[model samples]
Target: MPTDLVTTAGQAAGRVADALAGLDLAGPVRDLAAALPGGRTATLAARPGWAELAALGGRARRHSDALDAAARAYLDAEAAARAAAGPA
Candidate 1:
């Protein structure tokens, strides 16, 4: 069975995922990761050329998926940490 993470980290992971889910490239110009406390690290996994493509008016869904996967990895690592810390 899987373990549950500490409430704080779980909350952080969930917020990251929720923010990814809410991304809107066309709605308004805003930085999502900058808004989170540790979001800079979270965006490190984004695709290498997302902005260049966006600047060229190309689709960025694949890049977004890469970013989402990175967020999920963080969540998974957090869960692993919780497991290592012992049962909740």
Candidate 2:
């Protein structure tokens, strides 16, 4: 079911996020920004404070959180619907 797929995806994302939660993205972001061909965007990504790195990590975290929340909501709604339907 779609809910099952969502659950699996959310769980996978959450697990990955948890594992990489402490990872520092600054250096990698800087390296990538330097290597990228983009103009000012690359410069912004490589900024000294690593603010872009923080933002990137924050966005990923938020995405993972959103997925998990969506999965929970879908599961909850399915359960409620099934209960209302009752028996088969």
Candidate with top TM-score is 2
- Clash count of each predicted structure: 0, 0
Clashing pairs in 1: none
Q: Give each prediction's root-mean-square deviation over alpha carbons.
A: 15.8, 6.6
Supply the global lDDT for candidate 1: 0.48
lDDT of 2 at 36: 80
Alpha carbon lDDT of each predicted model: 0.48, 0.74
Worst 10 residues of 1 by lDDT: 53-62
The true-versus-predicted C-alpha distance at residue 19 of model 2, in Å, is 5.8
Please report how far candidate 1 places residue 21 from its true position, in Å. Answer: 18
TM-score of each: 0.33, 0.56
Expressed as tens digits, the lDDT of each residue in 1-88 for candidate 1 is 1222333444554555555554555332234434443665446534354344234322333444455566677778877889999976
